[model samples]
Target chain A: MIYRIRTIAALTIREAARRRLLAALVGITVAMVGLSAWGFDRLAHGGALTSGESTLALPQSLILFMFMFSFVVALSASAIASPSVASEIESGVLMTVVTRPIRRGEVIIGKWLGLAALLAGYAAAVSVLEMGVVDWVSGYLPPNPVLTTVYLFAEGLLLLTLALLLSTRMSTLAAGVVGIALFGAAWLAGVVGFLGTTFGIGALRTIGRISRVVLPTDGLWHGAIYYLEPPSLLRAHSLGQNENPFFTRSPPSWVYLAWVGVWFVAVLGAAILSFDRREI
Target chain B: MWQASSAESDGLVAAGGVPQATAPGEGAATTGSPRPSVSPAIHTLGLHKRYRRTVAVKSLSVSVGRGEIFGFLGPNGAGKTTVIKMLLGLVKPTAGEAMVLGAPVGDRRTRRRIGYLPEMFRFQPWLTAAEVLRLHCRLLELPRPSWEQSISESLETVGLAERAGDRVAGFSKGMQQRLGLGVALLGGPALVFLDEPTSALDPVGRHHVRQITRDLRERGVTVFLNTHLLAEAEQLCDRVAVLDKGAVVASGSLSELLGRHSRVRLKLSAAPAGWTTGLSAFGAWRTEGEWTTVEGVDPDAIADLVNLIVAGGGRVEAVIPEHQNLEERFLELLQEK
Candidate 1:
């Protein structure tokens, strides 16, 4: 089983590497890195009088930019994970491999590992480049940088797992589209939940909680925001008083993080089960 | 239920030796041998599959002997592929059981020793032929040391060695088909399921495939071949099953199926008026000019014809026994339904 999983993982990575989409994703990452570098350098050295207010706003601004990159990670994971399984099922390419000695669970896990590695590398590389640029120009860094980077990857992983579950039951296009739509809807619900909390509306607050439970991408991103925001910025604009979608008032609790892990395992288990029972 | 019918009808097996069960290993047991009998390579007992309202395979039971090339013949929608899938563990049977290589169907360990080339298979286009073999080797968990030599030999077997470095995306349909064959032959599996293995090949390639199949059998491998081409089956198969409407309509040795309906053509001179009446013992006879034909003449009836022709003062110019090819036998069987 171990050998089969490893073989599948290695082949999956090789397959992804040979695709044009990987090249496109790499190019997009490079352009985003370059753009962030130039933008930060201009902000730092423009001599528009380096004021205390701008320095104070640095963490908030950086979180906003990283949030954009997190969206890229989520989109990339959704794009790759769905088609990885669904297209093979549709095209009959998986018939030879699945009929071998390996268990269906091994195939699913191997694929998950491959996609996880790819998404993790992308998240780490982009986060490091963006953080390095912010530090080089403004000499400001977010608190708990490592934790922030992990949270961002967790967001991508959540989407990846969700997309895989969808692929077991639907077409590639339907899985991809539904995955991204859910991600977007969850983020909007999270924002609305913040508004409800501020305005004392119970129904709206419950909507956000339910959406997070259904799809944890937004919840994971909020955890990332909470980790990436500066201490002063977080203290000044307590989440309820702030309108910024990129900031979190408090770090997600230990229980929530545990649920994220549980959510991942449950969904991944469901995917393996569905795929095993599927006709092809 | 079906095995009982086969046992009763198989007078030759019972009369020639012992009463034999079609089930594998039973023949050896009835002969009082406990020396670890080699079971038939494939054995199915009333195997069946259904997709919602439609029954894909219904009560299929056949045993293929080891080292024999077993052909599965069926028309469109006759469930040949479904039966293959069930035996290979690619699909689950709705009822009954199948055993391949003495293990239950869908047994993962047994699958390790079996190779398959599905109809209309397409390898990953990005991988070169060598890389594809490597991937399959790894997937099959064949030891690392054996893969390099195996890949080379397999590619050479399918005549794809020169194109090993070329990506499958650039391959023609025939080349891809050859590569698929190479994949199936890799790791020296004990049994190979080849579905329409020659569907896309030219005549030469088809000949190469047939030769490879024969070579595999020579090396003690069992091949369960599913094909629409009866000539291929007739040339290679030791036994065959014809499936229609998801049921086994007919199955036996090629000669057994075709010989039951044999026809003999006779050209005679020196007329005897009552010769035609004597030939009635050989089933139905038709005469035109000096040529006479007898349809459905069994082996016993042929002797009567020769004796009557010689004793009646008729000159037997020539007697030709006509054998029906597989295509004709297949069509005749289908029409019988």
Candidate 2:
């Protein structure tokens, strides 16, 4: 089993590393980070709001940068993770490996490990670069930059896993689009839920709670971003607000985290079952 | 045990539908041999595979023997590739089961003893030919010491030794196919499945692959080849199964199937105005221009016809028995179905 996993991981990493999509992803990430740095520089120097003002100052800038970063990260990671296995199956490369003395679950797990590793590495590198720029220009840093980086990386990994699961049953194009759509919708629903909680709107809160449960990409991002940014920033813009009765904290409670883990396993299990039945 | 051997021999002859002349000391050949006496290397019982609503393989059952090169012949979309995939466990059958070496297919242990080369094989573009082979060796759990030598030997076998270091992306389509073949053979599997292995090759390359396949057979490998190239099948296959519309239309030793539909043709210097009447005893005879054609005729009857024609003052040109070529036989089977 270990040997099969290693082989599957090696194959996935080698194939993905050679794809033109990876290069494009890296380039886009760098450009996004660079653009964020430039925009933050102008905002810091303009002095429209004092650095001490949490709503319109450093906190807002940090939240805005993280939100933008998450989109790019999700986009790139989803793009890579989505096609990594499906394209292989379509091209007959998977046939070569799958027909060997390896189990189907081992193949899927190997690909998941490899893509997760890639997402983690990419998220770390880009987050570090963005932190460096923020420190260089704003002369302020988040209290727990490492924690924030870890959270962002974990969110990226989770999104990638979702994309991989979708990929097993759908075309690469459709999987990517659906993955991105789910990510966007979940985040939007979370935001709506937060507003409903703050404004005491019951129906909106229920809708947000259900969407977050269905697709936890947004919930994960919220937990990660809240953990990464300054407490003052999170408090000022109502950013840390969790509207759902199920998750009243900015980051999920232990129970919610456990539920998320269960969700991952269940979705992945379904994906593997679907793939095993596929005709190839 | 010796009695078991005799029973197995009888079973083989019966299952194969052709009797073999027992050679001296052949009974001793069964002892201490890696080959099994009972179960065939591969067996499918009414296997059916469907894609969505379309049936790709329907109730196809066949068995391949150890150390035999079994060619699966069919036109495009005739389930030849589907059956091979099912045997290799790359595709699941909608109904029935495929057994490899007496174990159910899709079983990991069964797959360990099998190798496969898919049609239009695609490899990781960044990998060199040697890297790809080494990776396969690693996956197959070949010993560390054997990796380098096996990689080199596999490349050498495929005539790609000189280009071992070259990235597969830089190689031509035919080169990639050859590399795929090398990967399949690297593990030294006892049973190999090759789908259209020579479909993309030139005539010379095709000949090279055919020779390699024959070499594998000589080394006691069971080869299941799926190809539309009947001529190559005729040359390389000991036995063949012709599939049409998701069913096996005909199967058995090449000679047995071809011999069943024998044709005899005669060329005459003078058109024997009534050759049909003269050759009526030779079975159904037809005159197409200057040639007289007879079907279902024995060799002795053909010789008799020649003698009678010469004795009847009709000059005999040439008496040639027109054997059914693989292509002709394939078409006839397809049309018959």
Candidate 3:
């Protein structure tokens, strides 16, 4: 089983490394980080917010930048993962491996581990780079960098797993589109739930909760970002005040975190089972 | 329920003991033996497969002995691939049973003893030829010490050792096919299924592959070869099965199949124009200029024809025994249904 996993992982890494998508991902991530630094530098000069005020506001900007970086990383990771298995099957490369002594489930798991390793590496590098820039400009950094990085890596891993599962039944293009759409919808739903809870809208809050439970990408990201920022950022604003949701106090609860782990295992298990039964 | 029968069959010590027998019109004796049995390298009974509405394989049954080179021949889309896939457990049969190495098809244990080279093989373009072989070795759990040596030797066997470090992306179609075969032979599998193993090769490349296949056979490896290239099958196969439409049309040793549909062509010189009148007793006779052809030649007819031609003042040039080629037999079987 371990050998099968290693083989699949090696194959996946080789394939993913060859795609033009990885280069595009690196370019976009580096550009985003550079752009964020430039924007912060400009905001630093404006007297509208003092150095101390901007320093405090650094967490919000860092969280927002991380969110954007996550989007880029998730999109690229999912796009590559979506085709990694399906295209191999279509082109007959999978036949070379699957017909060997290895089990089908082992192939799927190995691929998952390989893609996860890649996404984890990307998530860690981008998060640390962006956090470093935020610290340099505003002298502010997250108290729990390790926890925040783990959460980010977990979010990417979850998205990759979902993309792999979808790829088993759908084409690569369709899987990528659906995976990204679900990621956006999950985040949107979580926001709606957050607003409903704060404004006493019970039904809307229930919808948000259900959406996050259904697809935990957004829920996990929100929790990770919230954990990285200061508690003061989440203080409720007045009716006329305009504030980003990054300033909301009600981050994902412990129950939602537990459910996210459960969701991860469930989706990954389903992906392996579906791949096992698939004809290749 | 299906699982129980497979387990029972696996426990049976008799070699090739499935109750289903080959169709009986050919008069070929069933070769059954009893000593501990190499355990039915491949077995299928009533194996039916369909794509939507068209049945690709219907009630196909065959059992291959261990360490035997079994040839599977058929026309295009004649269920040869369908049968091979069923044995590999790649495609599940709609109805029927397929067993490999005494285990259910697709079972990991059975697969460990089997290797496969699919027809129209395509490898991961990004992987080097050596990486591809090593990857397969890793999956097959061969020891690390043997992995590199086996990879090199397998490539050398396929004549791709020089291109071992090169990515498959730049490989020609024939080169890719060779590398695919190299991967299949990496771990020294006891049973190997090769579908058109030499389909896209130059004559020299084909020769090399045939030699490798022969070498495998000599090493006591059972080979189940599916090919439309009749000449290659004739050269290497010990026993063959011909499939038409979705069923086995005819099967047996080359000599046995030839015996059932024998033909003799006689080349005569200075034969009279009215030779056709005297040759009607033979099964089927045609005269193209000086070459008179007679098919399904019986010994009595040959003697009579020689006597008539000699008595009629025509000298007998040469009597040639024209055996039925696989292509002719294949067509005959197709027309039979």
Winning model by TM-score: 1
In model 2, where do residues sit more than 4 Å from their true spots?
A: A20-24, A45-48, A54-56, A234-249, B1-38, B267-275, B278-281, B288-291, B300-318
**Backbone steric clashes in candidate 3, count:** 0
Which of the two candidates, 1 or 2, achieves a greater DockQ against the reference? Answer: 1
| Residue A65 of model 1, lDDT score | 90
| Tens digits of per-residue lDDT for model 1, B52-161 | 99999887767777778989898988999988988877788998666677666676866778889988678889899999999989888888999999999999999999
- When summed lDDT is taken over every stretch of 10 residues in candidate 1 chain B, the lowest stretch is B11-20
lDDT: which is higher, 2 or 3?
A: 2
Each prediction's TM-score versus the true structure: 0.90, 0.88, 0.87
| Error at A117, model 1, angstroms | 0.6
Clashes of 1: 0
Give lDDT tens digits, candidate 1, residues A130-248.
89888988787888788889989999999999999999889999999999998999999988887887688999889888888888788888888887877677667764464336766
User: What TM-score should be assigned to candidate 1?
Assistant: 0.90
Q: Write the per-residue lDDT of candidate 2 for residues B1-337, one digit (tens) a residue.
A: 1233332233223212323322223322433353454556666656888878898887766667778898888899898888888887777788876566655677676676788999966988789999888888877888999999999999999999999999998989899999999998977888899999997788889999999999999999989999999888999998888888787788778887787667888888875455445677777877787787888776556678777777666777777887788898888878777
Candidate with top lDDT is 1
Q: List, residue by residue over A1-280, the lDDT tens digit for candidate 2.
A: 8887988787777776776556777787789878878877877886676656623366556766787787777887788888877877888778888887777888888888888777777778877888888879777676777777776776777778888888888889988999998888888888788788778899988878898788877777767666555656545547654434222236667887788889889877877787787767
